[model samples]
Target: MTVIRCPGLLNCDVVEVPHGLRLLAADGRSYLLRGLSADRLAEGPLPAPLAHALDRLGLLRAGPTRTVAVVGSGRLAIDVAEALRGVPGTVVAELSDDPATERPGGSWQLMEDHSPSRLTPDLVVICPTDPLGLRPVLQLCRERRVPAMMAWCGPASAWSGPVLTESRPGCQNCLDMAMARRDPLWLATAAGLTGAASCWAGRSWIAGQVAGLVAAGCDEAAWAQPTWASWTPRGHSSAPLDPHPECWWCCQSGPAPVRAESECSAVSSSAA
Candidate 1:
């Protein structure tokens, strides 16, 4: 058990990470939350100037000079706001629609209820709890030409790179495939995600880290370093484009040919 008192705690409303764990006090709480880093840390080693960099150069600092409105109150959204405090952007948690769905591009409008003229977001962060929030907003962001990214939340079957609007390789559908292949144990608990509040503290931490990537990806300087990495170990599999014609999204050159009887729906790339 090692601990470091963070000086950065003096400025922020709360204690910063790697140091804040000591404040949790409960052994179990500390245990479940420890050693999640993809990189290893030796005990009692000198703490990096992490607290300082985290205080100054977190998610928001990586974003555009424009006001950044963090849309949802989900763990990632709140964590992004928390990490980006005093970084010169307006952060809001009002994008919930009824409860789960966030009004897509609410950040551009500067309000949860009002729709923006278009999804030309300087940066849009999606932390959808389920596909209900994911698909609709993804479709709309595509329609409006928003350069957006999705927060990596849970275990994925194959996993994708930083979900980016600029490229198709690093997209949500790849992450979706990764999830389908993973073992259910990866879900953690039935409350693997019960609500915005009840999810495992560990999961919350994971979401926050990935959301940090989402934040940093928005800022060109941060992303140029290529610092972001996956939160968990991933299994790899070959997913090739269909030899047969495909949907307009994936195969732009050729429209998918009509299917034979019992073909049912289009075969997902994961199957290929």
Candidate 2:
């Protein structure tokens, strides 16, 4: 396997200290190399043992560049894109249905075409202001077997995850089913809302959290269990989303055997 020095450390400054060489990376992180010479840090193939060590130390990166499509609108989407641009070996492209709206500090290319057929990203991060508007895109991703995750801020809350994929146990449809089950009027309530619901306070802190979640989800070796992170004014929390037995997306075989009403209540209470 070929391994190269981390691109984020390409412009790192190496200073000789009394005991070892200290590398100040471009991302403002510092590393201490006890015995290795600075010359060994060249961007080239590294021996297996050295590559393994450097990789463990976060000084090396291997694999092809990943293309990530960020689909959404508003400052949160742009902020997430900006944050992802800093990740090594990542290519980010922003896609929005509303091109007429102005996006500030959006240096990344805005793909005017919002067609799902035109995109083949390794992973899609959906953080649109109004998630309901992106339901069709989510369906397309499921059909194409493309991995995707969602991160967005609500009027008084923020959420991330349950990263969806072909083999994942749970999906957006399951989530919607669970929501509707928990609140019988959820679908009706969601329909009455307009695009105005997509706007949030635009907190930088929330953007960082959402971006971090999206970045972790991009990892190919990430955990397979479907979980979501949520934040409120009071604090933050996360929970695994179990697949709805009747979900048409994941439980295509058929609905699981129904449990007693008490048993159903227990399961819902635990998930809550």
Judged by lDDT, which candidate is best?
Answer: 2
TM-score of 2: 0.63
Which tens-of-lDDT digit does each residue in 1-272 have in candidate 1? 53433222222122225633322322232222243231222232112234223434331123234334344545555554454443333243334423444544334233222355332445555655432244455545555545445543444311223333434433444343334334343233323443434234434454445434543335554433212233334322234322122233334423334655221121232122
Q: Give me the overall lDDT of model 1.
A: 0.38
Badly placed stretches (over 4 Å) of model 1 are: 1-64, 67-69, 73-76, 86-94, 99-119, 131-133, 152-161, 181-200, 203-211, 214-248, 253-272
Q: Model 1: what TM-score? A: 0.45
Question: In candidate 1, where is summed lDDT lowest over 10 consecutive residues?
Answer: 263-272
Give the per-residue Cα lDDT of candidate 2 at 46: 37
Predicted candidate 2, C-alpha RMSD: 9.5
Cα RMSD (Å) between model 1 and the true structure?
Answer: 11.3
**Tens digit per residue, CA lDDT, model 2, 1-272:** 22234333334456666555676665678877676544554533333334435545565435457788877776677777777665555577777635575444232233223576555778777765653456556656666667877676666666676778776678766676676789766655555543445334434445555445544446645747888777777777889999988665686633334556542343333232
